[model samples]
Target: MFARVAQEDFSQQALYDELCAHDQRSRAGAIVTFTGRVRDYNHAGAIDGIELEYYPGMTEQALAQLIDKAVKRFSLTNAGIVHRVGRLANHEQIVWVGTCAAHRQDAFLAASFLMDMLKQSVPIWKKEWVGEQAHWVAAKGSDDDAAMRWLTEDKDS
Candidate 1:
């Protein structure tokens, strides 16, 4: 398990390699990874960049908890999450979630679950730059809906 809230940019290949390193011999048949990027457009206007902030120790602990939940729930072999803080340009990588499991379903679902939980529960905050003005980004209803779906499904199971 690896969870990091970094101030600098991360390489996708480096993360992927680290994820696979712990699971050799094809023990974990599936590895799923997700990368989120800072988009050029948002509800406010054309986004030039974003300033991301987080509560130091609390942020890392929250992320570790999310990874632990996914690992136990999905029976994953390994998991990793890396999120970038500070100023990020449009189209720059903002977040990465990776999961490994013996089967594809577990790996895929765990990766998705990690991302949804990260969005909803992580303490990181974002301020978007729209030309000369900057606005704090708020949690979206769609994100809430997406995160809630997992809870409902878990209950049904």
Candidate 2:
């Protein structure tokens, strides 16, 4: 199976429903989901909103490849990823990932792998509105470390 990537408005219920529907169609025994939300604060303090930027086709392609790797590595039955673009308010959802597999371990690992890879490899960038100023948020080194662990595991295996 291949990966799926979508740019959408911040909507938790919609994503939850989509995930539930995907899970229902599966013969797998387990499903795992991860949702990322816009927080009220950042390193700069209170945040009013955030604007996400991406390279359109390139971003989607990169995300799809990341998901494909996760699916293959973990033997996932199904996977869905949705990332919100444009301006988003505090407490709104920013991203979601769902994975279905025959066992809990595969489902869990796939879901984690998708998120970690997205954070590290995906080209989507964010500009945050904090009070009167806006700034671009840099990708965290910790995220890269997390993603690299999987690569190391793959090399070892």
Candidate 3:
């Protein structure tokens, strides 16, 4: 498992290749990946860019824990998360999550679980820019609800 929070951008293809490499013995039969990009608009207005900030060591630790949990919970052979922190223009990549498992279901579920957990638990902040104004992005109720759904499902499983 690997987790990184950086100001520099990451290559999704490179990360995908690395996760694929985890199954050198041809054991993992499925690989799942998710990419999150900064959109051109939000609820308020047209977004020029977004500035992401995090607590450095604290944030990386939190992300690592999430990755570790997903790997164990989903019986994944490998998992990775790369989150970009800094000012990013619209359409720029913000985050990537990848999972490798023996089954497609496990890989897909782990990827989804990591995303919801990251949004709900990670110590990262985003400020969206529109023209001459900027505002801190608010946590959406939908995001909270999605995370809660995962929690409920995990309990039943």
TM-score of each: 0.94, 0.85, 0.94
The total number of steric clashes, by the backbone 3 Å criterion, in model 3 comes to 0
Question: Higher-lDDT candidate among 2 and 3?
Answer: 3
lDDT of 3 at 149: 88
lDDT of each: 0.91, 0.77, 0.90
lDDT by residue (60-150, candidate 2, tens digit) is 8887887788777787777778887888889787887888888998888888888877888888889999777789998888988988887
Task: Tell me the tens digit of each residue's lDDT in model 3 across 43-129.
Answer: 866889999999979999999999998988899899999999999999999999999989999999999999998999999999999
Candidate 2 Cα errors over 4 Å, as ranges: 1-26, 154-157
- Model 1: how far residue 116 lies from native, Å: 0.7
lDDT at residue 26 of model 3 (Cα atoms): 59
Number of clashing residue pairs, candidate 1: 0
TM-score of 2: 0.85
Can you rank all candidates by lDDT, best first? 1, 3, 2
Q: List the residue pairs that clash in candidate 1.
A: none
RMSD of each: 1.7, 2.8, 1.5
lDDT tens readout by residue for model 1, 1-157: 8999998889999999998996675589899999999999987567899999999999999999999999999999999999999989999999999999999899989988999878899999999998787889999999999899988897223
